[model samples]
Target chain A: MPHDHHDHDHPHSLLPSDPALRVKALETLLVRKGLVDPAALDAIIDTYETRIGPQNGARVVARAWADASFRARLLGDATAVISEMGYYGRQGEHIVAVENTDSTHNIVVCTLCSCYPWPLLGIPPAWYKSDAYRARVVREPRQVLAEFGLVLPEGQTVRVWDSTAEIRYLVLPQRPAGTDDLTEEALAALVTRDSMIGTGLARAPE
Target chain B: MKEPVFLEPWHAQVFALTVHLSDTGVVSWPDWAATLGAVLAEHGLDRQLDGGEDYFLAWVAALERLLAARGLAGAADLDDLKSAWTEAYLHTPHGQPVRLAGG
Candidate 1:
C-alpha cells in the first residue's frame, strides 16, 4: 500500500485514458443526445449508496437466526421468500441462500463476471470483483478465506457457490455463539458485508 | 484486510448510467446484460481484470455499443465528445473539474 513518489510522475500521464474523464465525456454526450437523464442517474446512484445494501441482507440473516420457520422458507424458496420481504429487483430476480453450519461453510463467487444480488448487497467490494478473487477463490477457497483473515478449522467442509447470470448466491453465516439473549436488531449488527459474501464470519458479540 | 474508502467515482457513474437507461425503458435489462457479457468476453480474454478501471472500461465500451446500435447516439458523436473532454482536461488547471466549452 505504499505510494511510490515516482508513480506520480509516470510517463503517458497526459494520455486521455483516465476513466473518470471518459465517463464524464460519455455522460455529457448522452445527456446532450437526450438519451440519458442526469437526475435519474443521480437518483439511481443515491439509491444504491443509501437505500439498498448489505443492511437488508443483515436483516434477513437476523430473521433467519431468530425464526426457524422463516429459515425453512428462505432455504426452500429464496426468490419468493426474499420477494416477500420486498427485496426483489434486477440482478436479484433469482437468489439461492446457502447456510453455514458447524460442519460446513459456504462461499459465493462469480468466476465469469460480477453478478450479484443488488437488492440485498450494494455494489460488490473491490475484492469480490477482482480477477484474482474470481479465479482463485473457486480453485482455493480456504486459502483465499485465510487471506481475508478467516481461518476455518480443519474437518469443516467448504462449499463454493459459483454464481451465474441466472442465479446469485448469498451466504448465511452461522450465528455467533452467546447471541441467544440478543434482540433481532442487535443480532443484525453483527453481520458484516464479507460475512454475507462468505469471506468472513459474523462478529462475535462483545 | 484493509478496505479503501472508495474506488474511482466514475465507475459508479457509468454503472448508474446503465441502470438508469434500463430502468427508464431505454433498453431492456436482458439486452444490456448480453451486450456487456459479450464485451467482457472480448476484452477480458486471458487477462486478470483488477475489477477496477479495466472492468468499468469494458462497461463503457459495451454501453457505447448499445447506444449506437439503438441509434441513440452515433459513434462519431462519442468520438467528438471524447476529444473535447480530452482537450478540456489538458487545458484545465490541476485539481479542477474538467468541463466542455458551453457545457
Candidate 2:
C-alpha cells in the first residue's frame, strides 16, 4: 500500500478533510478491486435510507396503538413480535419495548456508544451518535429533550434506558390525542423517528 | 465490551459497504473476518477499540490489504483514488457532493 504521507504541495486545509471523501475513496477502491459491486452497494444504501427506516418502526407503533394484543406482545417480547413482522437482524437481536404513558416518558441512550435498532429504525442520525448527546442525555434528559423541542408536562417523569450490545431499547411513544378516528396507516405516518427515540413527540394532526 | 457506534455518516457507509459486499458474494464472511482480525492484530488493536472513531480507518486499511493480497488492486490504485478524492473535495463547493473530476 502507499505510505501515509502529507502532501506538502497542497494545503491540508484544502484537501478532503471530511470522512465522506475517505469513504468514497475506499468504495471506489473496492469496486475497482472487483470485490464489491457498485449496484449492490447502491441497493443497500437505498434500502436503509428509504425502504427500511423509521417507517418500519412507525408501523409497529401504529399497530400497538390500533391493536391492544399486539401492543401487549410487543412490550412483553419485542424481538419476537418485531421479528414476526419481518424486522429482526444484526444490532437488533434483542429488543425491549418500553411504553410511554401519562405519568412517564421514555428515552434511550448508549453512554459508551450508539446502539440503535437498525432493523426497525435503520441507521441512527448523526446527532444520536454525538458525544454531547451521549454525555448529556443521561444527566439531564429533560433539558436535552427540550432542546429537541420536546418539552413534556411537569407531571411526566422521564426515564432513560442505557443500551448495550446484549439489549437494545425502543420507546413506544404514547398515541397522540384526537387520533382515535385515524386509520392505522395514518397513525403510522404521525410517528417520527425522534418520537420513537423519545427525543420528540408524535406529530400532531393538522 | 465497547458499544459499536458509528460516529459519522461515512462510518455507517463503510459498514454498509462491507455487509453488502459480503452478502453479494464478493467476499466470504470468514475471509472478511480473518482479514479484519489480521489488520487489527497488526496494529495491536482489539475489537473493543474498534468502536471508536478510528475503527473505520482500520476497516479501510484492512480492505486495501485484502484487495492487494487477492491481486485485485495494488497500492498504486488506492493512491490514485485517494488523490482523485482529494482533488474532488478541494474543487467542489462545501456542502455539495464531491465527485471524481474528469470521470
Candidate 3:
C-alpha cells in the first residue's frame, strides 16, 4: 500500500489513514491546544463565492456601453439604476461604477478577504483572494497589472479600490480603438469579462 | 470519512468555473483558495476528504470559519453573498431566490 504521509499540495486529509492514529493526531493538534478551527475563514470565502460574482458587474458594464442615457444614469444613480435590472437582490443596494478613461484605469481588491461586488460581477475570480495578488496589487499596481498582461506607461496611477464595504466598484474601461462599425451587442461581446474587473481592457473589433 | 469528492456535476462545475473566472479577472476567489490549499498541504493537511465533493465542502467550511471569526459579517451577509452567487453562476431555470431582508 502506498504510504499515507501528508505533504504539500495534498496534505493530511481531515480523515487520517488509521482511525486510532487519527485520534492520536487530533489529540496532539486539537486536543493538545495546537491548531485553530478555521471555521470563520471558511465562512468568509463561501459568503463571497455564493453571494456575489463578477458576471453581475459585467452586465452593468455592458448596459452602460449600450446607452448614453444609461451611462449618465449609471454615473449618477448606479445603485438605483442597476436595481431596475433586478440584479438588486442582495448586498447590491450600493453599487459604484468607476469609469476608465485614457489616462486612468481601475481595479479592485480586498486586502483582508476577497470582498467583491457580488451583485455586479458575481463571485470574484479565485486569484483575487490570494495573498500575493491582494497584498501586491494595491502597493504595486503596475507590476501586478503587468502580470495580468496590463502594461501601463510610467506615472499612471493604477487606482486600486479595496471593495471591503457595501460600496463595490466595477471598472468601465474606455472603449478600445478601431472597429467602430461593431453594433452595441457586438461591442458588448468585445467587452472582455476581465475589463469589468479592471484587469484587462475592452477591445473593439479590428 | 468524507463524502465523495466531485460527486455532483454542479459541484465540479463550480470548481472549474471558479478557475475560469480567475482566468478572466475575478482574481481573489481562486487565489485565496489556492493559498489556503497550499498552506493546508504544507502543514500536512487534507483540504477535503476522499469522498467526492469533500474538497468543495472543505472550501465552504474554511470560508465560514474565516468570516465568522472576523465578525464583520453575519448570516444576512452570507445569505446575500449566496444569492448573488446563485444568480451569477448557478443559472437556475426559475428567477433568482427571494432576497432576504438583510440580503
Candidate 4:
C-alpha cells in the first residue's frame, strides 16, 4: 500500500473510466442541446442491427451461384448489377466483384483503414478492422487464410485486394460441390459472411 | 472465433450518431470518413487497435472533432456534460436509472 490513489477517493476522481458511460452522457447532452434527433439515431441503429447486413451479400452470392448470366453481369459491373437488386447506398459505391476461381483466390483488406462495402456487407467484423489483420493479410494472405482455417491448394494463387474509400470489393466464393440441386434460397443459407469476405469458404452441403 | 460487429453498445451508438448526422446533412459522409481516418491514423500508430473499445474511443473522438468543427458542440461542452453525468451517476444508488437534473 505504498501509493494507491484510490485509497482515499478524491472528488475529481469520481469520473468513471468507462467510455460507455461517457457516450451515453454525450448522447444525453446532444439531445438536450437539440443537435440530433433521438428518433433518427434509433432508426439508424435499428437499420444496421436489423435490416442491413451480410444477409444481403449472401443473397447476391447465392444468386450469382444459381444464375450464370447474373454472375457475368455482377463480375462485369458489380455496382450497377448490385443496385439493380436493390442493394445500393453509401460505402458501397463503385463496387468490384472478384470471383474465387480454382486457380486464383481473392481476399479483401483495408490496410490503411476499414473501407468496407457497408450496404452489401453491413458493418464489418471486429477482426476486419484490427491492425494485425490489416497489416498482415496483404503480405501473407495464405498464412492469414490458414488462421481462418482456409488452406488453399499449392497451385492456387492468393490475390489480396486493399480496399479504399473510393472503391470497395466483394469476394464471390466458389459454390460448394453437390449443391446443384439446392434452391436459391437454400443456396443463400450456405453462404456465410466470411465467404464474401474471402477469409473463409462457403459452408459445404449438409 | 466469431466476433460481434460492435463490441459495445456505445460503439453502435456512436456509429449510428455519425450516420444520423450525415443523413440530416449536418455533415457529409466523406467528411466523416476523413475525420475518422485521420483519428485512426493518429491513435493507431502506437497501440494495436483490435476494433474494440479503443477503436470506438477514437470514433467518439473523431465525432467530437466533427461536431466541434460544425459548431454543434465543443470540447468544453462535452467535458462539462460528462462531468455532470458522472456526478449524477455517482450519487445514484445501485439498480437505479441515472438521470440528469430535470431529465
Candidate 5:
C-alpha cells in the first residue's frame, strides 16, 4: 500500500530515514493484522497536504494587509474573525492575533507544549517543538529571532506570547516597504509560516 | 483540551497511524489508555512536573510497546531505524534536509 501511489515527483530517498521507514513498516504490519485502514491514513495526509495549512493563514494576513477594518477585527477578536473566515477548529478554537508595530515586534512560543493554531498553521515546524526552542524563546525572544535571520532595530521591543491549550496566537508581521502597489493575493504570497510564528520576517518585495 | 500541535511531520504521521489503528479495531481506546498509563507510570512522568514537554515521547514509547506486544513490529526494527536517522542527522550539514545514505 505504501508504494501503490507513486505519482508524486518526490524522490523517495530524500525523505527522513527513521520516520519514513517506521511509518511504512508500521503501516504494512498493521494492514496485515487487519487493524488499520489505509484510506483513513490517506485522508489524514490529504487533509494536511491539500485542505489545511499556512495558505489559509496567508489569506488572512493578506486580507488584513488589504483591509483596515478587517485588520482591526482580527486584532480585537481573532477567534471570531478567523471563525468568520471558516478557519476555526481543534487547536484553533481560541485564537489571538498579535500585531508587530514599528516600535514593537511579537513572537510566539509554547513552553508547556506545542499548542498552535492548527486550522491556520496546519502543523508546527520541527524547531518549534525542539526542547531548545521551548526553553529559550520565552527567555530570549530577540536572540531566537536573530537565529532565524531576523534582526530587528535596536529601538524595537520584542514581545513573546506563550500559547496554551486554552489559547493560541498568530503574529501579524508588519508589511515591508515598497509593497503599496501589490494586490492582496501578491501580499499573501509573502507571508511565510515562520513569520506568523514571529521567528522570521515576511518576504521583502523583489 | 485540544490535541497536541504536531511540529514535525513524523509527529502527525504517528498520530494518524494510531488513530487509524483504533478506528479500524486494531487497537481500542481502552487498550491504548492502559498502555500509555503504564508507560507514564514507568517513566515517573508527572504532567505538572514535566510541564508536558515529553508527552509525545511517551506516546511513541507506548506505541512501540503496543506494536511489539501485538506482534506487529519487533524492537530490532525500531532500533535500526532510529540509528539510521541518528546517523543521517549527524552527517547532514546545518540547514540541509537529513537523509539516509543509500536509502
Candidate 6:
C-alpha cells in the first residue's frame, strides 16, 4: 500500500470510551467465578505507581544537579542507578537519561503505547499522551519543542528519543546557572514537568 | 465456546478513574498506569490470572483496589461514582445511562 498523505482516520481508538464498568463486570464474572484472585491484581498495581513516580525522577534529577558522582552513576546506568533510589524497572525495564547541553537539544516520546520511565518520573501528563504530541514529535521534534518555548541553536540537531518498552528515557536538563545557592527543592521546582519529558527545559532563577 | 472478554466492568471503571484523574492533571502518564497497577497488586489481585491480561488487567485491577483501599465508596457511593463516571468518563448523558425501569 502506498503511503497516502490523506490518511486522517487513525484506527487506534476503536472504543470511544473503554469504561471501567467493563472491568468491574469482568471481575465479577472472573474473580467471583474463580478465574482470578485478589493477589494477581495487587501485583500489577504495586509494581507500577508508588514504586516509581516523578518524585523518584525528581530525586534523581536533583541528585544529578547537586552530586557529580551520583550523576555519573545515573548517566552510566539509568535503570540500576534509579533502582538504587528504590524504584526502577517496574513498568519498562530499560532506562536512559540524556543530558541536555547548551549547544545541543533532546526530546522524548513514545510512538508506541506510551513507554515512559515511570520509576524515575511520575505518571505522564495528558498533553504528553495526546496524538498531537505523539504524531508531531518524531517528525518535527525541533518545531514541537519550539512550540513548548524551547529553541535550540541552528547547529544543534534536536535528538528525539522514541521511548520503547525495552528502553525508557528521561531528560537530564542542563542545570540552570545563577542558582548556585539554591537548594535542591528549589531546583526541582525549576524542573518543570515537561522538562523531564524532554519537550521543555528548566527555567533560570526568578 | 466464546473467548474470555479481555476486560471487565469494574476494570473499565478503574481505567476511567485513572484516565480522568490523568486527564484533569491529577496523575501523570508513567505513574498513572504503574501506580494503578501497583495499587491493584497491593490489594492482592495478581496471583489470580496466569498473566493473560497483563496490560489491561493491571491498571483495571489497580482502579478497583484504589477505590476499595481508599474506602472511597460504599454501594451507594459506587453507584454515584458510576453515574459521574458514565457522564464525565464515557461522555454519556446524565440520568440516561439506562432507561427508567418502567416509565
Query: How does model 1 fare in lDDT?
Result: 0.83
The sequence of per-residue lDDT tens digits that candidate 1 reaches over residues B58-101 is 88888888888998867777778878887776677655665788
Q: Write the per-residue lDDT of candidate 5 for residues A105-164, one digit (tens) a residue.
A: 989987655677878988676567655687788888778878988889999999989887
Measured over the true interface residues after superposition, the C-alpha RMSD of each candidate is 4.2, 6.7, 17.7, 4.0, 8.3, 14.5
Question: Global lDDT of each model?
Answer: 0.83, 0.76, 0.55, 0.84, 0.75, 0.60
Instruction: Residues A119-173, candidate 4: write the lDDT tens digits.
Output: 8999988788888898889889999999999999999999999888788999999
Better of 2 and 6 by lDDT: 2
- Docking quality of model 2: it rates as incorrect
Q: Say which candidate scores most in TM-score.
A: 4
User: Residues B1-103, candidate 3, lDDT per residue (tens digit)?
Assistant: 1123234434433344333334334334544454545433432242322322333444444433443444523555555444443343324323334221322
Top candidate on DockQ is 1
**In candidate 1, what are the lDDT values of residues A80-173, reduced to their tens digit?**
9999999987688899999999999999998767888888987788777777898899899999999999999998999999887788998999
* Sliding window of 10 residues with minimal summed lDDT for model 1 chain B: B1-10
Between candidates 2 and 5, which one is better according to DockQ?
A: 2
Ranking by lDDT: 4, 1, 2, 5, 6, 3
Ordered from best to worst TM-score, the candidate numbers read: 4, 1, 2, 5, 6, 3
Count of backbone clashes, every candidate in sequence? 0, 0, 67, 0, 0, 61
**Model 1 chain A poorest 10 in a row by lDDT:** A7-16
Best by lDDT: 4
Please give the range of 10 consecutive residues that has the lowest summed lDDT in model 6 chain B.
B94-103
Tens digits of lDDT, candidate 3, A18-127 = 22222222222221232323343244345445644554565567678777899999988788888897676433657788888767788877664455655676644546
State the DockQ of every prediction: 0.45, 0.21, 0.04, 0.44, 0.13, 0.05
DockQ-wise, the better of 4 and 6 is 4
Question: Candidate 2 residues A18-89, lDDT tens each?
Answer: 456656777887776666787776667667656667888999999999999999999999999999999986
Lowest summed lDDT over 10 consecutive residues: which window, candidate 2 chain A? A8-17
- Backbone clashes in candidate 6 total 61
